[model samples]
Target: MHPTDSRSLAGNVAQLEAGRQITVAREDGFEALKALLPPPSRRALVLIDPSYEIKSDYAKVTACLRDCLQRFATGTYAVWYPVIPRPEAHDLPRRLKTLANQSGKPWLHATLAIGQAPDRTTPGEPAPRPGLLASGMFVFNPPHTLKAALAPALVQMEAILGRGRGQGHQLEAGG
Candidate 1:
């Protein structure tokens, strides 16, 4: 279920002709996440995409992922994070890595930059304004071939989506 109750978002989702079911949940993401329980035999994908407008969202994301890992350790989880200048943004990757180590889970982290950053020294923090300069996806329990499969695509995306200097991509994996 999509973790949003916005009428406009629900209306937009209704327009999608996806073959499978997609429910727009009318509740908090944490509540929806807690209620979900996939069977052990089946594989599931849990994607957490936050707007990161509030500083507290960074901690919330970590907490949400920890809960999901406890409930469904085998599921593939991907977290989409913006690359901004904030210290929270800078530390999220490391925090996720620490979590992975503690959980003994394999993880993959990939980033894409489409233009020059406002501050080179602080790449993780995106500007608090419009337009995204860079973004990253941290995946827990990624497939063995996921990195190989994505390397070329990341380069292609950099070329196609890049706007100015500092346009590039980085991919790293660890357990």
Candidate 2:
């Protein structure tokens, strides 16, 4: 799992009870991830944290996803980015939509958000500023039962992240 924040990664490790066999990549460099996995692990779940703010870097991500899809059963990709006021962020989901629409295999995507943006300053040492608050996922060849599992998990994740900032929607290929 690739996470931008140490706090979030630590929380996930504890909540998921990831075993001792797990390897934690404290740095953001993805090469470590590729090297850790075998040449053809087949399927995987990829999480891209808010670190991918530069759209140009998406080329590497897109290529990696394509290669994984061709060689694996399915690829689950989770992308997290702040809801910035620009087309770049919005365009990302659109491009992913185009990929799913053109692909023959089963696919799914979803967008999640917390509450509205929060003011920069507040009383009592200031509340944690609500981030632009957006996340998205693309699942290739997703299992039919994914909705049931993903929905509840997301709800719980939102709660742990904070309050009043829970919202999400899913898109499926050929739906």
Candidate 3:
């Protein structure tokens, strides 16, 4: 299921070819998320990939995760975030760690930095370098076999990208 706030995107999704079982909703994703939660959802994979244009999105994501866990603690949530030079982006992983600690749920934080961040000498000037410097995913209640399966894949990705200086993955288990 995909819920988008943009009407154009919603229209595009609706125009997709047949045989697609996608439930597309043109509404605020955070608000739409609650309605999608099944009462007896034993196992689920919730992917939260929001455009962090506004700082409030970070807080909303945290709140949504908290509520989702309260309703379905066994569900696995994968939050994808861009690795940018912003306070919210920098603090997301830490916030996720706090949430996992509070719930006593094991989580995994994996980051892939394709290249070094731009060298910004000026304080106010925007970082000029581009081409996806970094990206990360925080997985809550990860599968038991996830780490073993992803370890070698991450290594291969790092080798393929040719940027081993800071590109790597980390897994943290909750008690």
Top candidate by TM-score? 1
lDDT of 1 by residue, 81-148 (tens): 99988999999999999998899999999999998635445567755543788999999999999999
State the C-alpha lDDT per candidate: 0.85, 0.58, 0.78
Model 3: CA > 4 A from native: 1-22, 39-41, 117-129, 163-175
Model 2 clash pairs are 114-165, 115-165
> Mind sharing the TM-score for model 1?
0.80
Model 3, 34-136: lDDT tens per residue?
Answer: 8777545365788898888889998999999998888788888999998888999999989998999899999988887766543656888777655667888
Error of 1 at 95 (Å): 0.5
Candidate 3 C-alpha RMSD relative to the actual structure: 5.0
Clash pairs of candidate 3?
A: none
Backbone clashes under 3 angstroms, per model? 7, 2, 0
Ranking by lDDT: 1, 3, 2
State in Å the error of residue 14, model 3: 9.5
TM-score of each: 0.80, 0.59, 0.76
Local error of candidate 2 at residue 45 (angstroms): 2.8
User: Which parts of model 1 are misplaced by more than 4 Å?
Assistant: 1-21, 39-41, 117-130
Residue 30 displacement (Å), model 1: 2.3
